[model samples]
Every structure is written in structure tokens, then in C-alpha cells.
Target: MDKILLNGMAFYGYHGLFEEEKKLGQRFSVDAELKFSLKKPGKSDDMNDSIDYGDAYELVKEVMEGKPVNLLEALAETISERLFQSYSILEACRIRITKPDPPIPGHYRSVAAEIFRERNE
Candidate 1:
């Protein structure tokens, strides 16, 4: 399968396990790999035959910055669902979300979650 990759998308979101995290929000970085056939677009070079990633980025931003979810897992799941719902041509998707500073008192760069989903054939 071919891919359209959206990487290092940053957002400030109120998604976490703690009330403080939810109220104050934090910096979240996201990466998405959309799996689909590029055959038509590759052949015809038509916008109609391909998924516009700029639109995809906006979709991600909406989900990430919208409602507050308890976990990154849920956030990823929501994004995957929304992607498939909005774009019929999306065959599958992989989403990775990273929290730059989690609740735990650890000296780490970030905590993250990844999820992959495929359209039912």
C-alpha cells in the first residue's frame, strides 16, 4: 500500500488522566500515516484522485484540540474514526500521539500512544 504521511503536528490539548492536565492542557505532537492506493493520482495527477493532506491536517487539528479525552489511546482512536468517516478513499490509518510532559515525575522527553485501523472490506 502507498502512504501519505503527516508528521510532527503540534497542538495544545486538554487530554490526560489528571484534572490538572485536563484543565491546563499540554503540548501534544502527532504523526499520522494514511494508507491508500496512489495509483489513480500517480497516473492522472488529479486532485480528485488523491487525498489532500492539508485537509487531513486540519481534521487532525480539530480532533486533537477539540473535546478532552482521558487517554491518548482514545484520542488516537477518535482520530482514526474521523479520518475514515471524512474520507471515503482512506483505506487504513496509523496515528501516533505524544505528550511532551506527562503527569508522572520522570525525566523523559515524552509519553506516546500509537493506533492503527483499517476500513472494513
Candidate 2:
């Protein structure tokens, strides 16, 4: 299977269990891996034959900017669902949502959740 990878997509989102985290907002990073057969697109050499990165990015941005969730797991699941719904060729996908510089006492760069799902193809 061939894959289209979107890595280190940074967004400012209001998502957390804490009140201040949701109110003030923080940086979030997303990495998405979309799996599909690339033979058709590679052979045809056509944009329509393959998934559009711009479209995927826009979808991710929309999900990040539209809702205020309290958990990264939910955010990741939403992203995975949206991708599966929007794209026809995707067989499976994985979404990783990371909260960078979380308001935790311990020194940590980020906290993240990785969710994987497959389409009923």
C-alpha cells in the first residue's frame, strides 16, 4: 500500500481537560497517514486519480478550528472519520494529535494521542 503523509501540521486550538487550557488555547500538532493503492494514480499521472493534500489539510484545519474538544483522543478520532468520509480511495488512516507545551508541572514538550482506523472497502 502507498501512503500520503502529512507531518507536523501545527494549529492553535482550544482543547484540554483544564479550564485555562480551553480558555487560553495552545499549540497542537497533527500527523496524518493516509493509506491507499497508488498504482492507478501513478499510472494515470493525474491529480484526480490521487488524494489531494490541500483538501486533506483544509479538512484538518477545519476540524481544529471549528470545535473545542476536551481530549486529544476525540480530536484524533474526528480527524480520522473526516478523512475517511471525504476521500474515496483511502483504505486506512492514522491520526496523531499532539498538544505542545502543555500546562503540566513536569517538563514535557507535548502530549499526544494516535488513533488508527480502516474504511470498509
Candidate 3:
């Protein structure tokens, strides 16, 4: 039930339904909540017992910055899938992808898609 939070990780990506969005690209903010038992890490005091969040960040970066997905939902899905794959100790994850300047005309801070997934095994 313990948690490790990676917040406000920013990236530039071309992910949207509009051609202009794909062409111009946009800023994305990702917040990932990785859940698992932290007891081992806490007791061992070793990096190996805990998830290396630096690695997790790179994985999210690859998905967010690599593909030109048209929906934030898909983006979050891919991230969740990869997180489950990359970290064996990860039990569940909450992924939130936010677009700071989406093409939609509105007065708002930003729009985001959030998803929660748990390990299936």
C-alpha cells in the first residue's frame, strides 16, 4: 500500500486529434503514482529493493515523446502497460497525462486523462 510519486514530469510530444497539434507539438505533464510494498526497501536500505524511478521516468518519456498517438487515453494506457512490464514489484499504477495547451478553445488550466491499472497476475 506504500506509494512512490513522480509528479509534474514534463515532455514535448505530438499527441492529439488535430493535424496542427501533431505538426506543432505540445507540452505534456505526466504524474505517475506507483504503488507497491515499500517494506523491503525500507528494511534493506538498498536501491535494488525499491523501484528506480529514474528508469521509470525514461520509460514514460519513451512512450509520451516517441509515438504520435491521437488520444491521451491511449498514451496513458501504454504507460500503464509498460510500467507493469518494466517493474516486477509494481502492484498498481495511476497515470495522468496532461496537455497544457490543447487546441480546444476554453478557459482552463489544462486537460488530462488519468488511468489506474493493477498487475493482472
Candidate 4:
């Protein structure tokens, strides 16, 4: 399997379980791994032969920049679902959403939710 990585994606989003979080908004980071066989694309050496990663970036942006959600888990699901739905060549994928500087008291770098999915057997 081969991978196309969209890493360290940052956006300002109003997504959280708290009112202040939704109102004030916070930073979000996303990392995704798109897994598939690169043979066809590599052999063809054509952009269209492979998945359009720019489209994938746009897809992630649409989800992250769209509506506010109470949990990163849901956000991850949305991204994963859309990826599988939008791209037929993808055999599996991993989506990780991170919330930096969450409202928690303890000092921490960030909180994240990760989801991995493959085509149903």
C-alpha cells in the first residue's frame, strides 16, 4: 500500500462541548493518511491517474470549516466518511483531529481524536 499525507492542517473552528468553546473558537489540526495502490498512477505518470489530493484538501477544509460539533470524534467521522465516499480508489484511511489549548485546567499540548476505516468486507 502507498500513502498520500495531508499533515499539520490547521484551522480556526468553533467545535467543542462547552459554550465558550463554540463561541470563542479554537485551533484545530488535522492529519490524514490516504492509503491505496499507487501502481496505476505511478505507471501512467498522469495527475488524473491518481487521486486529486487538492480535492481531498478541499474536502477536509469543507468539513472542518463547516458546522460546529461537540466532539472531535464526530469531526473525524465526517472526514473519514467523506473521504471514502468521495474517492473510490482509497482502500483505507486514517483521520486525526486535534484541539490545541482546550479549556481544561491541566497543562497539556492538545487533545485529539483518531479514526481509521476500510471498505466493508
Best by lDDT: 3
Give the per-residue Cα lDDT of candidate 2 at 76: 88
lDDT of 4 by residue, 1-121 (tens): 7989999988888899999989989899999999999999999999787788789999999999889999999999999899989988899999999988889899989989998989673
Model 4: runs farther than 4 Å from truth? none
Candidate 3 structure quality by residue, lDDT tens digits, 29-106: 999999999999999999999999899999999998997999999999999999998899999999999998668878
Q: Score candidate 1 by TM-score against the native.
A: 0.95
Kindly report which residue stretches of model 3 are placed more than 4 angstroms away from their true locations once superposed. Answer: none
Per TM-score, the best of the predicted structures is 3
User: Over the stretch 11-108, how does candidate 2's per-residue lDDT look in tens digits?
Assistant: 99888899998899888999999999999999999989999999999999999877898889999888988898889899999899988888989999
Between candidates 1 and 4, the lDDT winner: 1
TM-score of 2: 0.96
User: Which 10 consecutive positions of candidate 3 have the poorest summed lDDT?
Assistant: 100-109
Name every residue pair that clashes in candidate 4: none
Per-candidate clash tally: 0, 0, 0, 0
Candidate 1 local lDDT, 1-20, one digit each (tens): 89999999999999888999
After superposition, the stretches of candidate 2 with alpha carbons farther than 4 Å from their true spots are none
- The global C-alpha lDDT for each of the candidates, from Candidate 1 onward, is 0.93, 0.90, 0.94, 0.91
